[model samples]
Target: MPSGESGHALKVESWGDPSILVTEFPDIEDFHGQLIETVLRLEQDPEFTRHFDGHVGESKVYHVERWDCPAARLIDARAKALFTSALKKENAVVDLSWASVYRAGNYCLPHSHFRSAASLVYFLDLGDEEAGGRFLFTDPRLKICCRHEPGRMTYPVGPQVRPGILMMFPAQCVHMVTPYHGTRPRITMSWNIDDKALPGNPLPN
Candidate 1:
């Protein structure tokens, strides 16, 4: 996409209510090397555990925040360009973080990002079948105990968030990972974005 047409635009659709679509914009800015290297370094870092207080011992959710890190800057630059080219309406800023899961039963609780205007998850390493890890996105089913209306909640979910794939969505959407039975570990990087942090790049406005 041309830089001129790469300005920000409305990237969401709806099914009665607005729905965020998974978009694919070419990695024209060349952040692939940086993204891959960052994931590798972070995975190998001994201090990787330090940033994951939320999922340290018993918890399924563990995360690390690497603010303004060199790799994060590159990720942000690529994300900004894509946001401009694809989501012309939204000025999206990138906030960097990573998530780690170590066991078969590890899974993330369904929740939304409170501080971000939008959120993204980049698949890094996916554990084996025993790990049983799968990224799930569902419609409103506020109570797990109660039955949701037919077709309201999508179960088991669609699309396995595979490596090299970057998934972006509205920040408030509730999503989670299904427990993996695989013995290996599952890791993913995430970023948050908001209007203010996002630079102004209009889509022919």
Candidate 2:
């Protein structure tokens, strides 16, 4: 954790041994490739146009966001269980959506989720032995990019990216994927949770 984030920010804690916990479950289940392929095909289909570059530096080409996907729903169910078990919030819901990212010449900007409790990313097809597509945090530490640590310990968030995995963290964490020079496109799924389902223009208590 960074300085100045104390008190006002949440802190990470030990699992089972402590009250609040942070856990990491690896290989929870292998994602079906066909399900991933089907979603990818839909995103690539001309009818489902890709979003235009936002005029930012090296803007990545992304498939128009997808929310009504069966595949996405499947992942949501699993993620909900994971989140609930980890956070001890049994009633928590894993709200999320799908989006195919086409990484060419290395793209993606640093940003955080606007209205989410937590955000996640699932690597579907990031083909490369030496490709960089890490889920980075704003702080140099607490980095999800460094390496596969045994426990759910915090590290620096720098230029590190991996594939064939699902990563979850606070929604406020600033993150971005590094460029990929792989032959195949980098496809992934991302989403966040909205526990309250609050009404629009929520009134104060």
Candidate 3:
């Protein structure tokens, strides 16, 4: 833990903890609108929600490539810069993209992307209020012992995640979302990054 971020307070500091990070810009819209459309479609699939705990609508497979859509282009370019800088690499490459949409009472189970170096989640709507869906990341160091008492041991300590927030964290860190109780569905874009993905080449694990 770095400086005053460790103890019992819920502060969103870098802390030099390679396992988590959060960036925010709540106003940027998904220009191509595929994210919104995808969320709506996925919500109708019964098989999808049960298959992956309310997750569906995975982005098309691409070879570390960028799409013509403005939002895709932004994620491709800006995300690459963010990943490369965070991982201290010159050619960080995104492996693939996926999405999830959660309605009232839907949620994801705690899990980790153990195969990837880093992972990212771009939120469209983080639910309506604190009563709705809340993204949580268990501290890997003390996940087993951590408590979820409000104003005491905020089990998942994270930054204020509004729309357009791009959250990046170590792929091996355990995280999950609390059940959403909002009227609207919660939408997000998730992708893994590989620092070994050189230009014009497949990513190396």
TM-score of each: 0.60, 0.61, 0.67
In model 3, which regions exceed 4 Å deviation?
1-19, 26-35, 38-68, 142-154, 197-205
Q: Which candidate would rank higher by TM-score, 1 or 2?
A: 2
The lowest-lDDT stretch of 10 consecutive residues in candidate 2 is 1-10
**Highest lDDT scorer:** 3
Residues 1-205, candidate 1, lDDT per residue (tens digit)? 2122346442332222234444343442455456445555555555553333333212222233353255555445545554454557456555534445445555666767656666776665565744556776654633321244654564535354455555666777777766566665566666665656544431111
Local accuracy of candidate 3 as per-residue lDDT tens digits, 1-205: 1011123322232422545665554336535266465445544554332234353222222321433344555555655666766557777766665556666777766777645688887777665677556777765454332554423434564455777667778777777777777876667767788876534432223
Per-residue lDDT tens digits for candidate 2, residues 26-145, read 332443455555665665465543443521212222322343555545555655554555566646543435454655555567766656676666666665656655544543334233
lDDT of 2: 0.49
Candidate 3 residue-wise lDDT at 146: 54
Native-to-model Cα distance after best TM-score fit, residue 151 in candidate 1, in Å = 8.1
TM-score of 3: 0.67
